[model samples]
Every structure is written in structure tokens, then in C-alpha cells.
Target: PRFKSKKATRQGFKTDRAKIIKGKLRLDKPHGIKNWYDIRMSGDKLLTGELKVVSICRENGKYWASLPFEIEVANKAKTNRVTAVDVNVGHINYTEGKINTLPDNLKRSYKRIKHYQRMLARKSVINGKRATKSNNYVKTRAKLQRDYRKVANIQHDIMQKFTTQLVEEYDKIVIEDLQVKQMQMTHVAPKGLQRSMFGYFRQILSYKCDWNGKKLILADKYYPSTQRCSKCGHIKTGADKVGLNGNLKHGTKHNEYICYECGSVMDRDENAVYNLLALIN
Candidate 1:
């Protein structure tokens, strides 16, 4: 066998009888397994309805089970509160006239991850004289993989909390249609900075909003959100002459936006937020 005989990638099994008693998922008389086996249910909500099918699977050195059930949810009451989120390179701009810096837990431990990765790479290759690697090589490789796993876990936890907070508070959420994948490919920004988990954040927002009965909107990519004035119906454009009137202007740091016609200065991201919110209401 290519792999160890005792290990298998996946398995298919089914059971019609299962129940949750005393905060554990119990299965009765599973073939080639113990009778009435139960696993403790922690950090999981008990889905409503009869337990139809339970599929247990393993992924990324972890065990997970998929429980499917049917439930009915009534429509949620509409609210007047609306939120607009504009994603940026360093931070995010949202409605209510506030700016929030994007959170990246992985950045805090990047050096440690790099250290382990370096150790792994240096020990993985066979030397000119040595035909095989030593046990230390395997150990270094495992350490590197574990470090990456830690990063993933941290990212997932942060995104889950942030998305839940948004879903619980706001009924209507609007965000810009950012081209994250394109940004990563172009290498226009720093490699670490561009590889944000914005896609994962949006994916969570989608399903959480649906489950909680909320509305999410993505504005058009080329909507000229930054160029348009939030207060007035004015568009900013390049100057026709050196002393041309109604020429668009911005701060040198690119932190603020200046309207050409209305002559109002505001945070760049905040300006974008207002433009996006104006689309729906």
C-alpha cells in the first residue's frame, strides 16, 4: 500500500437512529463499532427537527461531522438602521461616519511562522552524502505545518466573531465589490498586506445574513464612489487646464477626499461609504 494500512482518507457510513441526550450525539448499533456510542456536543447549536442524516468526516488533521435537519424560519421585521462598509488597503470605512482598521491576527505571528518554515525546508532535502533524512527532519516539518494550522485557526475565529457581530446589530449591510483576487495577482501592494482574508469574511457574511434574515448589497466595482461628492451631485475629473475650475483634489497622504464642487473634505473611506448607502435608500 502507498500509505499506512491502518489509515484511510475517508469512510461512508449511515445510521437511521441517533439522538442528543445529556448534551451528546448518540448512535445506536453502528456496524463494526461500539453500541450506543456518543460524542460530546460543544460549541454547537442543536438544529431543530428530526435528525435525518449524520455524516462524519476528517479534514486537515481534524474530525468534523455534518448534521442536516429541516427547520422553518419566519421573516424578520425591517429596521431603519443601515450600514455601508468600504474595504481599503489598511483599514475599512463604514457608514455612521467611522473608520476601522482591518484586523489581522496572522500578522502578529508571521516571524514565528517563517522561522519554522525555514527549519522545515533546510532539513527536508537529502544531502550529497546522506541518502535519507534524519528524524529531526520529520519533526521540523511537523512543526512548520502546525504553525500554519495555528494561523488558519486564528483567522477563522476572528472572522466568525466579526461577522456575527455585524449580523446581530445591523439589518441592512452594504459593502464595495472589491477585486481582491486581482489585487493579489498584480502585486501592486505588499505581499502580506494584499493577502487579506476579505473573501472569507464576505463568505461568512453571506450565510450568516441569510440565517439571521438580513440584507447584504455589493456595489458595482466601477461606480466612481471616491470621485463623486456625497453631499452634492458633482463628479471629480482631471483638470482641463492648470487653473481650471471644478478640478478634483485630494490630500497628499490619500487619507481624505475633497469635493470639487461642494468643497467638502472628509475621510476617503467615509465618503465611499455614503456613496454606497445612497444606492438603496
Candidate 2:
């Protein structure tokens, strides 16, 4: 890959001529470079098997190295357990009647990022007419970049843990094939839906399930999981499907789902998960 002169732009290269020694990554010196570098890796787990490739990159004022190893992934033992999940803007609902929300720390990180972004914007406006950037402006920009990286790391960590847990505990997993792009483009899309990482969550869940020998079922995008009653198999149609404010009409609360046919009432997200689970069960 081509390297940019500026530090802000991402630059990286891949090399297979590298090995780990005593927890340090040793790389061969390239042309015109005199010294070999032994970079200490972060993880505690011992890397085994043939190291296929190592990607070295400078990102967000930090150097990152990722080594991919060729190894066999053994299948997880079967438990015959199955579950369905409904991923929403801020939380996830499960067929097991559990709800998990984005952690407080992550939310705070997001808030901080927004604050830093606004600060950076102000600094940029101040620097726009100047020939050189002020030290304070440069510092603020760096801080904003760091916050962006921090939020990404936190999100990735949470997603990794959640996907790994699901793959290990369940033999079959069900999730909606959400039209996330369409939702994002729509004028009246749900609040926070544009910022939600539904696509990333689905991507990770899919690969984890594949790696661990688990079955992942994607309910059709048009499936009426949200509009269907979990207890009575009744499907809400027309304006009754969703209220004028984009909620179930049968319930006063935003997340409450009520069956008109049978008068069954439950949390909307849980009801959706149940409807998704019914496909495989």
C-alpha cells in the first residue's frame, strides 16, 4: 500500500516475513532500513501454527499490528439449545426473555466523541483562514481522533464477547435480516437507528456462528415479526400495524405489544423475538 506524507491518513502494508519470538513480533528489515524491529504484541495467548500474514498500520495516532494465523477451528459441542434475538437501537431482546442494553461506558464514550467533534469543528473554522494550524487546534484534533478510536475499541470488544457467548452457548441462533441501509436512508426512520451498529453486530454474529459450528438463521427482511402477536398468531395490518408515531397501536407504552384478537400483551421486542424463534422451533 502507498504511504501518505500526512500522519492523519491511514497507511499500512502486509508482510508474511515475520515471526513471533518470546511474545515479541520480529520483522525482517526492508530495503534501506538498517535495523530489525521486535514489536511486543498485546495478547497473552500464545500464537501457534503458520503465521500467514501480518498487517502493520498507523491509525488514529497509534501503530497497530494484526497477525493472522492458519489454524483449524474445532466445532463447539452441541447443547441442542436454540434462541432468537431482536437487535434494536440501544438494546437486544432475546427469545429467552432477556434484554441487554448498550453499556453505560459505551454511551458515555459516544457522548464524549460528539463533544470532541464539535470542538474540532470550531478549531477547524478558526484555522481555516490561517497559513498554519495552531498547536491547540492540532491538539484538539488529535484528541478527537483518540476518542473515535476509543469508541471503536469498546464497541468491538463488546461485540466480540457477545458473539462468542452466543456461539458457545447455543446450537442454533436466529436473527432478523434487517434492511439497515434502507432504514438509514429513510426520512422517518427510527431515532438512533442510523447510528446503531446493527450491521456490524450481524456480521460478527454470522462469522462466529460459522466458526463454532452453529446454525444462524436470518428471518426475512419483510417478516412481520414486530407486528405479529406471539401468543395468538394474529398479524396487525394497515395503520394498526404501527401507530402514527411508529409504535404498536394496541399498547399505550412504546415497547408494549398487544394482540387485538386474543388480548395477549407483552413487550414488543420480546414478542418479535418469539415470532423469529417460531420459524425454527
Candidate 3:
């Protein structure tokens, strides 16, 4: 069959399952489960593996059975290298012995999804309609889910690439143990941008590091990575002292800090990154 859109392709692959039981298959509507069983069984024969667990998920009016499997592979040795990552709204900054930034793909995707959501809201308002489990509403909801899935796919892809690259190149990865829950609570910035990216990046980094046999070192949340200067052991206090503007500067209430001894202009995050790197060495 010719695929028109990703939504159609996903719908084509959905399972019509009646029940899911641990590792066993008890088929009532075995649409997704059957496919998983077949694939795992064939792969097991070819590679001598086993199916572990079968679970179910519900999203956008569709039910799915997830079959997880385990395969044996040879263990590898550790490589001693270190990288530090700092996540932000527009980009992810990292030090793989040098500074780098990852594209803000998730943020961009969210912006696009937000546009569609706004349109849907407008349509519902104009028609004075509330969504029921009607066919049209269901279809619209599915489309929204598809959009979400697409964004998720994009995020997953970017994270995989970035993590894989880091793991392959560096054995020891250091990252700020960002207080994500606290950030979410204190976030007054536009769209809660900082809160959105921090959690996902940390999750991806953790798993990828594990898979590649690399060490993930998480710096403490209160380590003051951005406030202390790397070049000199100087601490900058207050928001304006750190060269931060607008909502980006969290400690904006106080603005007077001077490195009277060295006379260095301080930028908080940059200072933090430098300090983080200093800790590595």
C-alpha cells in the first residue's frame, strides 16, 4: 500500500489487542501482539534471543502492545575520557574537551505543534463545539497525536546521535545534575523553556552513556557551575553582575559583584561552564 502520511503508516501498524499478560500471549484481538511475537521469534531463531515482557499503552484513541526482548552481547572495556553537558532552551552546550552546542530541535518542533494546537482551539471556539468521541474529533485528535509522535521521533533521533557521538568519543561524561522539578516550579520564563529541555536531555544522556559503557558524572545542583570563574577562583554574586538580561537571569534582584583582585567581567553560565571544565581537569 502507498503511504500518504506518517499518521496513516502508524495507524496501519496499530495493534487490536484484547489483553496483555506478562510474557505469554493470550490473543483476543491480537493485532499488535502477534506482530511483535512473530518478529521476536524470527529474530530469536536468527540470533538466539528471547522475548521478555509484553505491555500495553494507550494514546490518541489507539491501544498498543509493547513486547520487550533481551539479547546477549559481548562486554567491552572502558575508555577514560570526559565530556560535560549544559542544557538550555535554544541549544545544548557541552565540553568534549572543547565547547559545542546541539540544535534546539525539540523546541522548534514544539513551536510547530503549538501552531496546530492554536488552530484546533480556534476551530473549536468558532463552531461552539465540544469534543466527544465522534469520528471527526477522533481523527483530529489522532492527527495531533501523530504530530506529537513526529516531534518525539525527531527528539529521539537527535539525542541518539548526540549521545552516541559523545559515548563513542569520550568514556567519562560529566553533566550538571539540574534540579528539573525545582526549575519547573520556579520557571517564569516564556513557555517554561528551560524546564522542557532539561529533563529529556538528562534521560537521553543517562541511557546512552550506560549503553556505551561510559561513565556519567553528574555535578551537584548547587555546585555553582556558572557563578564561579574558571580562570580565577572568583565568585560573582547578583543577577546584573553576571551579565544576564531579562528572565534568563534568575538572581536578578542583586546586581553588585566585583572581582576586585582580578577585574574580570563575569558571565554566569559561561563562568559555570569554565568552572565545570576546571573540575574535570
| Candidate 1 global TM-score | 0.69
lDDT of 2: 0.78
Give the per-residue lDDT of model 1 (tens digit) for 1-281.
02233245343455557677777887665466554557888776654676777766543445567777767666455565788877666455666544333445566556677886766555555353241256665466556656666777766776687677777778999987777787677645645445456677688889888988899998888787776778995766664111112223322335656665777877666777888889888
lDDT of 2 by residue, 1-281 (tens): 34655653677878888888888898876677766678877777878887988888987557788888888889999999999989887777785555344578767877887887787677667767451267776676677778778767877787788788888889999999998888877676454675457999899998888888899999998899998998889898886775424554444666877777998878788889889999996
TM-score, candidate number 2: 0.89
Model 1's number of clashes is 0
Clashing pairs in 1: none
Cα error of candidate 3 at position 41, Å: 11
- Residue 13 in candidate 3, Cα distance off native in Å: 16
Report how far residue 218 has shifted in candidate 2, in Å: 1.3
State which candidate, 2 or 3, has the greater lDDT.
2
Number of clashes in every candidate structure? Answer: 0, 0, 4
lDDT of model 2 at position 90: 71
| Candidate lDDT values, in order | 0.65, 0.78, 0.58
- Residue pairs in candidate 2 whose N, alpha carbon or C atoms collide under 3 angstroms: none
Residues 1-281 of candidate 3 have per-residue lDDT tens digits of: 22245444253332245232442445444444444442222222332256545554556756566655476644335667666776665456666323223246655666777876876676677665565335665666667777788766766676667777787778777788877776566535534554346677778778767776777888888787665656678665664244324223543421223344587754445555566766667
